[model samples]
Target: MKRVVITSVGAVTPVGLDAESMWQNVKQGKHGFAPISSFDTSRLKVKNAAEIRNWDPVAMGLNKKEARRMDRYTQFAMAAAKQLIDSAGDLSGIDPYRAGVIVGSGIGGFQSTVTEHAKFLEKGPDRVSVFLIPMMICNMAAGQIAIEYKFRGDNFAPVTACATSAHAIGEAFRKIKDGYLDLCITGGSEGSINEFAVAGFQNMGALTESQDCDRLCIPFDKERSGFVMSEGAGLLLLEEYEHAKARGAQILGEIVGYGATDDAHHITGPDPEGDGAAHAMLHAIREAGIEPGEVGYINAHGTSTPLNEQCETAAIKRAFGEHAYKLAVSSTKSVTGHMLGAAGGVEAIITMKALEEGVLPPTVGYKVPDELCDLDYVTEGARKTEIKYALSNSLGFGGHNASLLLKKFEG
Candidate 1:
C-alpha cells in the first residue's frame, strides 16, 4: 500500500484561530471555557462553553456577501481549509481532479435550522431563504471546500457524531494509501454552539453546568461533572508520501494506522466494558505493527464526563495492558473543552505536534483523579517526552469509535 502523511494542519478552535496558536495555548495549559457570548444563556442552566470569540470572516479574506450565504460551520471550514492550503504551498501543480475534500460535521448549520424554523413559523412559507437547505446540510462543509479549491476527486462528509472528523481522516488515509488521490483535504468543522444546541445538550445532561471557567472542563477528575459544549473547525492536508516527497512538501507526520468500531451499546453513552473502544485501539496498534509499549503518548477521548473518562480509561487498559501505565495519556479537551465533532481533528493535530516537538500537552484542570480513571494522565503541566507513535481516540454518540495512530516523521 502507498504511504500517507500529513503535510499541513489548520484550525479555528476556541483557544486560537490557527493550529500553531492553539498548540501554544494548549501547551501552556490555558483553558478556553468562558460564558457563552453568541447567544443569551439566561434561560438555560448551562451558561458557559469553549466559544471562539470575535471570529470575523471578512477579516480572514472572505467576501462579506459570500460569507453571508454560508452558515458559520461552512465559514469555519473555509477558514481552516484556506489555512491548510496556504500552509501546504503551491498546490497549483497538483491536478484538481487528483485532489479531494472530506470535512465532516456532527450538526451542520444548527443555528440556521433554529433561526429559519422560527422565521417560517412566524412568516408562513416564502420567508425561508433558498440557501437555507444548502447552508444547513451537514455535508456542505466538504461540498463548499471542493467548490472553493476545485477539488474534483472524492468529496463528501462522514457524519459519525463526534467521531465524524476522525472517520474523515481515516477514510482519507485509506484513499491516499490506495492511490485514489494525491492530495486530500480532510477533517471536521462545527458551529452548533447556539441556543438550540446548548439547550439540547443541557437538557440531555451532556454539558457542564458549572459557571466557573477554571473548573469547567476537568476531564478524568473525580469532581468532573460533564463536558463543556464548544464549536470550531480543524483541517489537515493529507498527501501521498511519494507525491509529497516529489513536491518537497514538509511532512508533518505519518498516519500509520486507523481503526474504527461500533459499541452497539447505547446511542449517547459509551459501553462501560469498553469492548468496542478497546478493539479500536488494539486494531490501530496492531495495524501499525508496533508493540503496545512503543506507543509513548495517547490523546484520549476524555470528555470530562464521568462515564466517558471511566470507559476510555478501561479501553486504554484493555488495549495497552501494563504499557498503559507507562505511557503518557492526556485529554486536550481539558484545555479546549468538548469541541463535539471537531474534537478528533484538533486532537489528531495535537498528537502529531507532540511527536514532532517532543512535548506532551497536559490535561489541564485535573485536580483529583477518579479512582476508576487511574492512569498516568500528564497533569503536571506540559512534559518533555519523545513520542515515536501516538494514538488519537474519538468516541462519539451513536456508538461510533475511531482511533488514528500517527508516527513521528524522520525524513
Candidate 2:
C-alpha cells in the first residue's frame, strides 16, 4: 500500500480567510463569535454565531455568473479549492483519472432552499429556480469541486453530519493509500447560518442562546451550553507519498491511520459510555502501529454540549487509560463555534498545524470544568510542546465516529 500525505490546505473560517491566518488567530486565543450579522436575528432565540463577516465571493476570484448558480456552501467550497490548488502549485503532470474530489456538506444550500421555497409560496411554482435542485443537494460541493478542477477519478461526497469531512478525508486517504488514486481534494464546507437552520437547532435545544461572546461555545466547561452554529469551509490537498515527492511538493503532514465507527445507540447522541468512540480511537492508534502513550495531543470533538464533552472524555480515558491525562487535549470549537460539517476538516488542519509548530491550541472560553471531564484540557492558553502523533476526532449526529491519526513529517 502507498502512503498518503497532506500537501496543501485551505480554510475559510469565521476568524480568518486562509489557513495560516486562522492558525495564528487560534494560537492567539482569538475567537470568531459575535452577534449574527448575516440576517436580522430579532426572532431568533439564539443571538450570536461565528460568522465569516464581509464574505464576497466575487472578490475571491469567482465570476458573478458562477456565484449566482451556487449555494453559499458551494461558494465557500470553490474558494477553498482554489486556495488549495494555488498552494499545491502546478499539477499538470498528474493524470486527470488519478485525481479525485471528496468534499462534503452536512447542510447544503440551506439558504437557497429557504429562499426558493418562500419564493414558490409567494410567487407561484413557476417562480422556483431551475437551479434549486443542483444548488441545494449535499453532493454539489464535491461535484462542483471536481468540475472546477477537471478531476475525472473517484468523486463523491460523504454526508455524515458533523463527521462528514472526517469521513471524506479518511476515504480519500484510503484511495491514495490503496493506489486507487494518486491525488485528491478532500474536506468539508458549511454555509447554513440562516434563520431556518438556526431556528431548527435552537428549537431542538442544540444551540446556545447566549448573547455574550465570551460565554458562548464553552466546550468542556461546567457552564457549557449547546454549540453555537457557524459557517465555513476547510479543504486539504492530499497525494501519495511518492507522487508528492516526484512533483517536489511540500509535504505538510502524513495521515498514518483512520478509524470510523458508529454508535448504533442514538440518532442524535453519542453512546453514553462512549464505547464506539473509544473503539474508533483505539483502532486508529493500532493502525498507526503506535501505542496509546505515543499520542501527545488530541483535537477532541468537544462540542461544548454537556453530553458530548462527558462522553468524549470518557472515550479518551477508555482508549488512552492513564495516558489520557498525560496527553494534552483541547477543542477548537470554542473558538470557531461549531462549523457543523466543516468542523472536522477545520480541526484536522488545526491538529496538523499544532503538530508541525509544536503549539497546541487552547480551548478558549473554558472555565468551571465539569467533574465528568477530567482530562487535561489546555484551557489557560496555547501550550508549546514537541510531539509525534496526534488524533483528530469527529463525532456526528447519527452516531458516526471518525478518528484520524496524523504524524509530523519526519522525512
Query: Where in model 1 is the C-alpha error above 4 Å?
Result: none
lDDT of 1 by residue, 239-269 (tens): 9998999888989999999999999999899
RMSD of each: 0.9, 0.8
**Model 1, residue pairs in steric clash:** none
Q: After best superposition, candidate 2 residue 377: deviation in angstroms?
A: 0.5
**lDDT value, residue 337 of candidate 1:** 84
- Each model's lDDT: 0.91, 0.93
Error of 1 at 232 (Å): 0.8
Error of 2 at 4 (Å): 0.7
Instruction: Residues 1-411, candidate 2: write the lDDT tens digits.
Output: 898899999999998899999999999889999999989999989989999899999988778998999999999999988889999977989999999999999988898999999999999999999999999999998998898889999999999999999999999999999999999999999999998889999998899887789989899999988998888999999899999999999999999999999999988988999999999999989988889999999999999898999999999989998888999999999888799999899999999999999999999988796889998999989998999999999999999999999999998
Estimate the TM-score of every prediction. Answer: 0.99, 0.99
Residue 192 lDDT (model 1): 88
